[model samples]
Target: MHESLPISVFIIARDEADRIARAIDSVSDFADEVIVVDSGSRDDTIAVAESRGATVFRNDWAGYGPQKRFAEDACRNDWLFNLDADEAATPELVAEIRKLFAAGPPGTASFWQVRIKDVFAHESGPAPWAYGYNQIRLYDRRVGRFSESPVHDTVRPPAGARLGQLSAPMAHRSIRSIAFHVEKMNRYSTMQADDMASRGRRLARHRLLTEFPLAFLKAYLVRRYALYGWWGLVISTNFAYTRFLRLAKTYERELAARARSDSGAA
Candidate 1:
């Protein structure tokens, strides 16, 4: 067997039995250790992770950032890579990472942003010009760590920390189906709404009217979802709906709060 890199790959999961193995397998060959922090999964998530040679720990369901923070602390190595249970590192990405570590520690770069491309349910992989976003997935814990916000699970590198970008992209197999996407969006929107409410954010009435169409245009055109043809339309529509739903739900919370204030005054 080849020597593993001194990197700890951590994943925060819940009921991801069917897909967690792929995430683990993708990094198992190169990473020194794989840490799976499961959040009360009823499925065989823990069993599957353990069978695949992952060190599994059960944490209760916290929000995204906190969950990732928990995983970050649990990692043994200073160099860490965070992969979701539904995502996998492509061979090119793996090779690139391996190359980075070949000649001792990476110079100057404390964190590396990786492009995470979406792989639709029917597709085997991402298209040549797939729409994707970059995130700091690989980093040294001393220089960077996952944010604590419940809704935002991004890595926050210290000021002036040198950041590098990986050319190869990771595959995100997040969408199971249209129904599944909708359900996922619904849950996400609720969390987003709650987060906004906690932060005292209020949406204007005009946002309810313009949110869907504006979001649709942004996703379909600016984000290049149009490249996927009809599938792109479906994806864009879902994306738009998710955005609008969050705003609507947040507005609903505002209205409810106002009603509560009025009742208490009476």
Candidate 2:
């Protein structure tokens, strides 16, 4: 018989000693178990998580989707909530989740999507909430799993699976510093390039030449990043640069491959 467990929260971590504790604590009262899968953190991430009553495990970093799926496999309950180390479940969200389980999860829906709100802490205290997007975090693992893409993976619930949305937003403490944000962009862009190359994808010449401006417009104007002032500009600019980097790296890979093939023919 399946245990009547309510929800199990899973988080994938890597050198997140500075932020993991808060993430774990946010869901501690409501979650049956909090699982943290670390990818060889050189910091005290594992220790901090364990101290907070999280079941910690070590897994070699393969890709974002793979690491998250690994945590899914470790979970004991069917109902799961996937959270990032920099994200926290708000009190309202936690209450809603508890209310969900009290009445029993709906058989109609496979997952619940939640809106995310970006927040920052200044010298004084927590800053005003900033804009954020939505993601499918609460789900039944039997019907949904994260897509296995190396970069920018998301939950892939079935076409017929009923999906619902929640009003309260999850708080995200994103981009702690400009340096941190830069490092993430560089890393994710390289991952995108490698994933594309391994799949035998040829670099799109048109995209290489024109994609950055389109990306910038989408992020800054359409996405309302302009509302945040200079930070919005910086974030939107980073988005554009990442798009360019991914295409540029993919182009380089194609060039190297063609050179190898030509040399062999000669």
Candidate 3:
């Protein structure tokens, strides 16, 4: 067996019994402890995580950032790795992380970013030219913690903190199926809209006309989703629609506020 590192890997899950195992298994061999924070999953998520030897904690749903913060505090180690229930660390990524700690704790780097690529249900793995985004997944909790935004769940590294990047990629199984993807997007868009409205954000009326097309072009052309052909088209279209939906919902909230103001004046 490979020597385990003094790293605590945490995963927050909700009704993800089917995919959470992969996330836990990927880190099981090398991590000192695996922590799974379950937010009241109706399915067997807690049971499955326990079966895989992950210490499970029950927390009420409080948005992404808060949930992750809870998991960070629950970790026993100063070094923490955050993995989504739908994502798995590739063998290459696991090796890279091990190498970082081979001599001792990573030198001056307080956090490391990993490229996370989408693995569609139809595809066996990420394409050679798959589009991915970088996120800070491994970090010293003392130097950084996840932001508390309800809609944005990203780590906020302190100013001047040293950062490093890992070339290896993490596999993100974000899309279960076309139908499931749509449902998930709808829910996310609602949350995004509510967050925006609470922050007093307003959208120009003209944005309703241009948001979808602009978003589609960025996803399809700039993000290289076009490389996936028909699957790319479907993904891009859905991505555009989600963006448009958020703007529309935000605009609706603005209009309702205006109507209330006018009624009060009358």
Candidate 4:
């Protein structure tokens, strides 16, 4: 009925007790192996994952890319499916993956996952894709690896690697609550700003002024978040705010560096 590929489903998490079970269960029906790598989660995250038939391991936090790479190395299969703690594959997606493996993974190198459908509890269910498309996550470990950035980590696929798109989309349950959204916004913006700092990037005043409004417009109009009504408005505002915050944090860091230099001269 389904195809199996000795595929290993690897998830790197920390304190994800509330949703890790669902993420793991989504793949249990099809994955050959499932592993969860924890990074000092104080909660019962470890216990929950273990109960869900996932082989659990504790590893120190080493940034997103490195931690994911660590899990990638631990996988026994050459094919790896990296899923976020909050992301789950729909049944149709599972069927697609089965079909892909049965037909053989894209000879081009690895598979790029479909832009996950963002789901919210308030709406009927998962919202339709209107606003943005996401990058790839699933790939063959042999030809691709995630970048080792301390903050901005993206998977690097080999040259000429055919990146095929999956027809089935992963469900992205991102907005847990307003409080959680704000916290996540702060954390991710800081991480992004830090990555920019590492690359010696500075914020331009023009960019600082334009980024938020442009981001809001793109999220609301280009991405078509407007179709969702109130939910769309919230997401657009959140996107715009996130853009502003990342630029603001980067600007703050730049100002701090300038102050330090001026003080040294004085």
Q: How many residue pairs clash in each candidate?
A: 0, 0, 0, 3
lDDT, candidate 1, 1-266, per-residue tens: 56899999999998899999999999987999999999899999999999999999888877898899999889999999999999999999999999999997798698999999989878889988788899999999997799999899999988888999999999999988888889999999999998888888778899999999999999999989998899889989999999999998998888898999999999
Weakest lDDT window of 10 consecutive positions for candidate 4: 123-132
The digit string of per-residue lDDT tens for model 4 on 1-266 reads 24456789999899899989989998988788898999999998899999999999889998988998889988999888888888888888888777777766556547575667777656434655533356677788888888887675578887787887876778877778888899999999999998898889877899888998999998999888888888789989998999999999999988899999999999
The root-mean-square deviation over C-alpha atoms between each candidate and the true structure, in angstroms, is: 1.0, 3.3, 1.0, 1.9
Supply the global lDDT for candidate 3. 0.93
TM-score: model 3 vs. ground truth: 0.98
What candidate 1 gets wrong by more than 4 Å, as runs, is none
lDDT per residue as tens, model 3, 38-125: 9999999999999999999999999999999999999999999999999999999999999999987898698999999989887777
What is the C-alpha local distance difference test score of each model?
0.92, 0.85, 0.93, 0.83
Better of 3 and 4 by TM-score: 3
Off by over 4 Å in 2: 1-5, 120-129
In candidate 4, stretches whose alpha carbon ends up further than 4 angstroms from where it belongs are: 1-4, 103-109, 130-132
Q: Please tell me which predicted candidate would have the highest lDDT against the true structure.
A: 3
Residue 56, candidate 3: alpha-carbon lDDT: 98
- Residue pairs with colliding backbones in model 2 are none
Q: Is candidate 2 or candidate 4 better by TM-score?
A: 4
